[model samples]
Target: MEGVMALMRPMPVSPKQGVTSPRTSVRRSTPCISTDFSKRNGCLIRAQQLDSTEASTTVPPPVSDSKDNALQLKEWEVGKLQEKVAASQGITIRRRPPTGPPQHYVGPFEFRIQSEGNTPRNILEEIIWHKDVELAQWKERKPLVSLKKALDVAPPTRDFIGALRAAQQRTGLPGLIAEVKKASPSRGVLREDFNPVEIAKAYEKGGAACLSVLTDEKFFQGSYENLAAIRDAGIKCPLLCKEFIVEAWQLFYARTKGADAVLLIASVLTDLDIKYMTKICKILGLAALVEVHTEREMDRVLGIEGIQLVGINNRDLETFTVDISNTRNLLDARRTKIIREKGIIVVGESGLFTPADIAYVQDAGVEAVLVGESLIKQPDPAEGIAKLFGKDISI
Candidate 1:
């Protein structure tokens, strides 16, 4: 009993947080299946390994009838598969902590020790981990069935892509998707007296083709209430729910809240996830604004079918670094030809400020720009839009 109890005790804390103690060492026999607990002091902590053949071949039993042991094993297997697939595609941002899943019983003893893999490597990873917990609570409170019913009386979908196209033709410059953001993790409080409806209205009056409302409450200090308010306030511009979407359920949730479009970050999602989410977006009548930060991500997104609008984000979500040149770099000669042929409306997102900045991305071949920090910080976001374009684009 004492031997079993020792295995359950918390690992010794290191002086520096997130740094593993010298006394502890975690060894993986395979990338996803096995963890070597080895010997801790005099205690012979048994290593746990999942059979690769069983993990690959076993069909997960239905959750409704599955035992707790079956469910835990299934979840652990799924997590491993996700990690393996994401790594192959150059995605470093894990969907969950690399600590595998909670192992209720390892061999005969109950094992519940916290592992070093539980620590998030970066800010993006941290946010994603929190989101996993947040979504579980949200799902329990408001399931997909309730959200579908809400959509029955929900506001009619708006033409997000059409609006961008029309705005570009009207202004003879990159169409604007002005953002309604209160604060960002990197920039802190952008607007002291933030009013979503007012800011949205100002953007519409300022000739913004669309409005991107940050819905991430923890990191960006935004909410669905802000999105709903903007729509209910009769803002004419099509609304985009700027969210870190990890699940398809968020599509229904965003649609019910009056989102005409949603943002999908390629850095955090696999190509299969993008395809599946894009299909769901089509069903919900919400445009998917697939965002990419790297050349590999851009290439991955381009290969996906039915992607109408692609946003090149200049800010790296993992590092929160801003560089406008990222926009120009991704839209080089070869990719430019492919994008033109496919008729994809490219939107330059993040780091865009002045008219010169606008011209730089335009010269690189973007038809639209999603600017938030530059416009939302202004005395009037409407005027900020005019200043950004260096001319009045208002209708």
Candidate 2:
């Protein structure tokens, strides 16, 4: 925790009325890793795929998009299958209309310069570069390789999720560490009036095992600065930095924000990336709550050794839709076997507002819960936390 304490940096956020500048800064020196990967194999793979794709009837890129990038548009059509499945289930699906093609951000990789035939190397890149955007990591200031060693590497500091696992092993119900998120892209503006320090105090008073803060500024309306304030205000609950982690740089950054744990969405990354990133989170003394929404994501996580905490997100990321039933759908009987056998601490995330909702997921097997809206709306956020817990947190 100390290793990461000096690491959590103050995020860019507007200070609330009563809040003032923090007397301390949480900046840690970072060790760097090489960001360059040779694209020779990628080019070969693309050439072969392009030849095969071209052999089939020529599918031109959508007129709305660039002509040279035609194949990517065609591939984007396939990613929509997840949406199709949700709609078929009679779930109230509010599909955000197909977005106009987006420009891609090219990463600073050397291999990107060489044109492989025309295909994207992996699915991860497909989601990233589908818009002709640069898909490589660039140095905002320092390269990844250079940041690999200058900083002190921290070890995994298990938090609420970990504590829950311990409780379950002891008495079957791990503690509930609910969130205080104000908004998410999937369900915009979760709570109208939000205060971080107050909410953390509420969660603590409500008997919450810990607090999870959505620190992403763009999508979540959350900030690391809020976390820093939450830390400075002297809350006892540990904080989870809820952000889209596209880089390990963010993990290092999370510790600087006084985060005790961090979320890693499984679908957005490959298996190798998950293993590597989770390991990195441990090295930084932050809890890595590896999240999964599907069997595939679960399988990837299960394959990794020594992973103690797992969260099942009820919300779909691609479509930004919440499916509370996802809690049940994901944790079937077979899953129970693996969970119980391996002692994996499972958490159900999103769309939970009531004690009944908490009971539903808890009955489904999640010993812990993560929520936002319901608690935020309450006059006393701590009471909301207790209500969600179905017990007196004030006790």
Candidate 3:
């Protein structure tokens, strides 16, 4: 033991013997995984002894989750992940916040999928994606034709189209577009008294330049009865048939339903579709409001010929994120040269609250707005229009 300590003292290799050989010294300093490392999941490694005079010390083993180590490990568990779960018991684990379903989106992008050991992603996402694609393929169908024809020949005096435009010009900013909804997808019931004629009268009194009547019965819970009611009610304001225009049958149906206008979503339709629909709208004496969300959609809307009204929607139809700035961004894209030449009517749609929001979009280049929530929430919807416009232009 004395000779061992003496040897280790000169160039210490072992604590007990202190035998100093170059090979042993080199081997001693090399990193070694604790024989008991895996026993406790890489914890409880006690340093035994060291010869003080040794030039080098043993390198600590790199932390790992490989089967080469003693601890039980999964193939997927590696890197920083191995550090997530501790070696000791009675200790809580901290996890990186989950990559859960998306909250809001700005544009189209593929979603991230997570699964255990890569078994396979659930079919639910695939199903939804397929449905989205199916909806995209519905481009072949056009619903604005016969409906336009019916509207053009509608008995309620086709000459009254000028009056509606005149009223919009007469009214100031955020010019009124009153809603005639029997029910909505959200609240279900809109007007319990639901008289289209009476409601039209009230809206007219309320100073509305146009009326939006939900005609989609499946979700919105509206009916053509309301459209006929308003049409026969002799309410002067032009009517926008709020229908899911998936098929051309809907447009013709809209004419029979007594609508003076229809919505054409740019996301759902290509430029050719918009041109065809807008042309149908003109032929049928209906005004078309080409609605867009993203810059791509705005560009698509602009490509359509004979487009007079372009609606920039804050509420996204797919994910339903309502960003008010969406309207301004789209409106700002319009060059002064194009706007003056086309004389485009820009309508800001949805998610408007205060007069400030109204004024914001109007200043952003919108001549009129299609407001629903703010006006509907009011005690007197007619008076709501007055509050929005800041003046009474009720006829």
Candidate 4:
């Protein structure tokens, strides 16, 4: 019994031997004792607790990601609101296709499937949608700040309205605003030879009051380069930058590129947009040729103050169909009376191929005519202009 008691005595431990005082605590460096079940269980429990703590404390996403998502949501909401406003004003065309779900999640494959929400309803709508994307890319290349700076050295603007009025008074007929068109969506290519400067000079010599240069490249195969080239070539006729003016930035861009006037389609823009854009045009010394197709569109444009030039586009832009009677239908007695009172110069656009066609629109009260395909298709655009007016108006 003495030997067994002596063997069972507790051994003394030094500070370096991994023993802690009763008042202090120290983590164990070695693995849990396998022979001791309690120690093994405690080690497993502590490990699990540490893992639970780490799992509860998750890392947050970057701040920029959250901000970008918020911005996109706001833009989407604003777009929907704008569509509603346009619908209220009887605009059937949408500025862009409706937004859909994330492309990756919508279909089985990586690409998005074609649907009504993502597809354009008509040619006009398709053009507008494409224009929006193209404008975004252009804005990135030439920001508004740079465009504003460019305005300082831009060419002086001519009096587009005065030119038309003078031409009509001198010729005793509707003034001609000849078009420098390369190709149209409906008609593939107007002139295979397609020299913009040459065409502009011919039109000027033929007594064209102003020139319309189609500046849309995707559909029309026209460009700002053509307008600049024509202006640099010393053509006297005022040039109309025939563009789908969606934003105000385009007005500044047009002005810098030697555009004396710009086309503002009433069907594409709202009443408020027309008013605002007209004001901008006034500040920039650029004329606004607000074109209308339907009676409602004409009324909308007529109601806006300070509109000097109103164009009646006889072609249905949505359907690519032409009917000269559209100009006659929109400009009735009451509208004509209002137009005369306001001192507005009415221009009949599209589908005028003959002298009878010009006379019909003039009888309906248009002071000018915008003829493109008929004139540009002929071997001599100048002679085409004479034939269109039924006389040598240049004399």
Candidate 3 Cα misplacement greater than 4 A, ranges: 1-153, 156-165, 186-193, 333-336
TM-score of model 3 vs. true structure: 0.59
lDDT of 3 at 97: 14
Candidate 1 residue lDDT tens string, 1-395:
23322333434432243222222222322112122222211222234543434222322222333588455545555566676778889999978655433323346543333333544566787778778878999999998678868988999999999999999999899988999999998889999999888889899998999999999998899999999999999888899999889987788899999999999999999998898888778877899999999999999999998989999989998889999899989999999998989999999988988999999999999999999999999998889998999999999
lDDT of 3 at 62: 28
Mind giving the per-residue lDDT tens digits that candidate 3 earns over 1-395? 23222322322123223212122112222211211111213211122222333212322222345555322222113312322322121112111111111222323433222222111122222222332334444333433333445545565423323444676677655565677766654456755656667766777788777887876554456777888788887777788887555334455556666677887766555454466566555655677777777876776666666887777889866555688898777766445356657877777888787778888887887777777767766667778777776667676
Q: Model 1, residue 378: displacement in angstroms?
A: 0.6
Count of clashes in candidate 3: 6
Across 65-125, the per-residue lDDT of candidate 2 in tens digits comes to 4665444543444324433443443322222212221132233332212222233333333
> Which structure among the candidates has the greatest TM-score?
4
> Model 4 off-target regions past 4 Å?
1-65, 100-108
Global lDDT for candidate 4?
0.79
Better of 2 and 3 by lDDT: 2
**lDDT for each residue of candidate 4 in 203-231, tens digit (9 for 90 to 100):** 98888999999999988999999999999
User: Residue 353 in candidate 1 has what lDDT?
Assistant: 83
**Model 2 TM-score on a 0 to 1 scale:** 0.63
TM-score of each: 0.81, 0.63, 0.59, 0.82
